[model samples]
Target: MPRSILSWSDRSLAAQFALAGGVVMVLSMLLIGRVVAARIEESVVRNSALATSQYMDSIISPLSQDIAEADTLPPGARRALDEIFTNTPLGERVASFKLWKPGGLVVEATDKTIVGRRFEVTDSLARAFAGEVRAEFQNLSDEEDRGEHALGLPLLEIYSPVREVWSGEVIGVAEFYEVATGLERDLAEATRNSWISVALVFVAIGGVLFLIVLRGSRTIDRQRAALTRQLGELEALSTRNTALRERVQQAAARASAANDRALRRIGADLHDGPAQLLSFAALRLDALRGQLAETGEIDAVERAVKDAIREVRGISKGLGHPDIEDRGPCEIVTGVAETHEARTGTKVAVICDLPEGLALSQAEKLCLYRFAQEGLNNAWRYGGGRGQEIRLDCRDGRLGLWVRDAGPGFPPEDAERHEAEDYSGIGLAGLRDRVESLGGSLTAGNRADGAGAEIGMELDLRGA
Candidate 1:
């Protein structure tokens, strides 16, 4: 989650990416620098060697031609060889040059004292005497060599024979020595140029790399801040959700308590007021009947009293005056089934296989009673008072309730649209909400017989 180059010291993705890029940049620039440096060194070496070789070629032909006529005039020939080395085309082009006789005696050298002494550089002289030219390199043989002017690196030497042209007689040889100073100069210049190029390349690449690092750092910081903000928001949201759940629970409890109190008062009021008023009216009607025993008014009073008593009974049934709140959920459920059977004038069957003594919270009991009550009402209204069935059972510590009627179920589209419409009485939506509020589920569907609608609800009892 930490998105930065520094954060990637331990295999982070951002660090990995940046590291790979820097490595590639460094490698590519270094490789290019090395290739350019090598080429520059090669060119320097080639030019220096070419110039030295060309100067040697120019002096060689003239020295060989002049020396051929020398042995006959021995007096001036050695001096002539001396002049050949000192005044050659590139003055002092050969740091040291020598001429030797076929038997390896030094015929001539620029140093006059060693003209006749056997040359210490015998191998190089012998190579020339054998009629072959050879080039070589070595350290400056003296201890005084140092710095650019000194031949410290190595020497380049070319050795070749000078001979008699007409008779082919082996006479002498010439050996050229170019000390290491000359080669070192060319090499140093090449190194300097190479370093300059390296500096420029390093500067450009380093600038780009640093800029890339800067941009990447900024990006990582932004992402880190964003993630932190999101986490804070999520924590706040979770807290709010928990508080809302608690508030809902408290509201439901208060509502249930209030409903319970209202139900008891209503039950008391119906039993006291309506029952007494109807009883008083019946006694007065009996007294009037006796008083007018022989008159037609007596018959009329008898009919009016009978009508008032029947009306009161009807009002009580609709109000669910006694059965609604006077009993437990189980009794209330059983009583509704019996009332439906009697009032609908249809065959209403009830199959109650519930275990006895099932306990429920007040909220849970109210939801169960209301759901069953509305289901029966819907079945009676829609089924046109035809056959109805009700079922309730308890097993595995859970309860299941069902109500059915022998009539076509509501059209699927109409049910979906009108299910929310609650003009009066408890509709299907209210019943469903009631069931769900108590942590139970209710569903409606066509009965298995393919001719009716069935409503089912299930609830956990002890688990509720």
Candidate 2:
């Protein structure tokens, strides 16, 4: 019930059982010992009383015969009782004696002052009148027992019935008190032995149970300690793995940014060197067309050079990412969509619902730019540029982008096939990897309406 006791109990199963079982064993031993001691004393007292009553009846029954016909004993019977007390060997053992008639009248007594005095009828007196004997040891609370109380000796009080000689009818009661110092000593020894035996048995049983519980408690404690150590090791390993994962993510992001910068540099090189050379060759062919005799060949050569220049410029444009470091998410998305529309000559619907002040890292912005570029390019190529839409918004602390087109969606096998194949181009697989590097996800599938294909990406802005 107290905090300290609760803590002790929590220490182990054996300690708890010891505390509870010890209390139960002690109480059980005490109860059993008390009952056994009481029964032993009662048995000893009753046997002694029965033997004394039988002997006393042989001597006093004839002397008390006058009580069957009269309430008072005659003088001769009274003198016989007095001589038995004064001169007989039985007098040395017995402390007091009485003869009674019906209605609680004491016809004769060793204490002569009580002769012919009436008292309340007790249960023992009633049972004796009905032909039963009753006895008690050292119980001197009765009014008639005052003299015996003063004697201060352990006494056995007995009530025995007196019978009429001719009719064998119980007509009166004889009550006596016998000294019981020997019986009291025997009872005291027996009680002590009984208590000791009960206590020993209880202790033995409790010890056996406690030993069994202690064995089990020790096993459990060992197992618990082992489990605790294992759990601590697992926690340490988990912390190390988490730190490694963060490092990997940061490396991926940095690599993506560096790759974007490299592509931008390549784009500038193509536009400035090869593209300019192809444009100058096409101009020289146009000027030399008028002087050539075969104008058809000259015109065809000029057209091929101009077409190569256009292809190189397109490759350069596609390789470069727009400047988006200074822009918010909404502006970046809108700028990419507008650029896609301008280059492809296809109408792309743009919807921006991004929150105010939405911030993004440089790597994240590059990823977003590439995502929009690839998504719209796929829509225009596969969907014939019909119903192309780019949706961007921030919801529930996450930033999301979706590009949808009214076209037959990707087949189920397309995703599996893409994963198994290797490609150097910037495609959906590449975009997926870039998104994942920044702790985002990309999914390309059919729209829920079943009328179009959709490419969606979601980024948790909390980390950003």
Candidate 3:
């Protein structure tokens, strides 16, 4: 299982370039160091070769003087020259000399037996005979074999013109061998110096780079923290916006309900209070009319007075005013039936099946009373002016107020269905608004049980 990085900036680039750079730097230090050391070795070898050449020149000068001073052909003098030439060292870095006649013939050599051979023979000898310093490296073809024995080995050969002391004529060729112990020593010294320098350089670069990375990391952390705080603020603002919208919706619903309740209360006041006062005054005027007939004191004035009181009572009832809330819904329904009995000579059946002291709110009680008043008024005024009966019931969690008549029920589409002026019990529309808001239902039409008209309402026990 791999662990996740807990922070953003702790990761380092572990890649090929870093590894390669380390490897290359080490290898380069080794190689360049070797080159520097070898140069030192070559310099020492060159110095030794030059010193050896000078020593060989001293020996050659004395031998040539002794040979030139021999005026007669003497065997002893020849024997001495041969001994001196044969005494040369065979080690590397020693000069190997060759003498040539003016006609390009080899007369003497550092190799005593091969002396007197023609100078125009092998390629190296032919080049030397032409007065050129025929220098070469590695007798064979290996690159590391460079700068070794060097005659026919790794060597840098210098050919100086050797002349006879008296005649000043060209004589032999001199070749010096270069060796490379100095090159190896110098390369080792260079390797040590370069390693220290490269290490110090890398340390300085790494330190600077690390500091820059550290500062950058701190700046990024600060930015991230600030952004997180801003995000938190934005989230809080969003929550406040949502709460404000909810409060606004609640306020709108409450305002609409308040307007409906106010209209209902106004209607109830007109129907129950003012309307009944006017109606009672009209009944007194009819009594006054009887008295006027007996006294004959301005009969026209008494008739006009009664007419005016009746009109005022009609106006109040149309505005939904009446004295009805004083009694219980059961008593109101039964009394309206008694009025129907008196005015149209009809009977009404009313039943009360509610729990004792079954209380109700002001709006619900008013609605029940208004419904009963209109039912009785409809029976007295329009049920053939005579013979109809209404049945009312209260039962199991409901007040079932209904009225029925034997007179012709109006059509379902009658203009009086919800007309306030026609029905007048604080208006059918007002009854519906109150009952339904309390989770009850009201309906008006012909009775489902019979052919006469019926109007009934139901109230939920809990809601009422």
Instruction: Name the best candidate (by TM-score).
Output: 2
lDDT of 2: 0.84
Better of 2 and 3 by TM-score: 2
Error of 1 at 20 (Å): 6.0
Model 3 clash number = 17
What TM-score goes with each of the models? 0.43, 0.62, 0.34
Best by lDDT: 2
- If both were scored by TM-score, which would come out higher, candidate 1 or candidate 3? 1
Q: What are the per-residue Cα lDDT tens digits for candidate 3 across 41-74?
A: 5565456545655665666544544333332214
Alpha carbon lDDT of each predicted model: 0.63, 0.84, 0.54
The residue-level lDDT of candidate 1 at 305 comes to 61
Query: What does candidate 2's lDDT look like per residue over 64-179, in tens digits?
Result: 88888788888898888888988668888888998888899999999989988999998889999999888988788989889989999989899988988889899888899888
In angstroms, how far off is 8's CA in candidate 1?
A: 2.4
- Worst 10 contiguous positions by lDDT, candidate 1: 140-149
Clashes of each: 1, 0, 17
Task: Decide which is better by lDDT, 1 or 3.
Answer: 1
Task: Give one digit per residue, the lDDT tens place, for model 1 in 344-432.
Answer: 66666777786666666666666666666667777777777566878888878778888888877767666422242211244677667
Q: Order of candidates by lDDT, top first?
A: 2, 1, 3
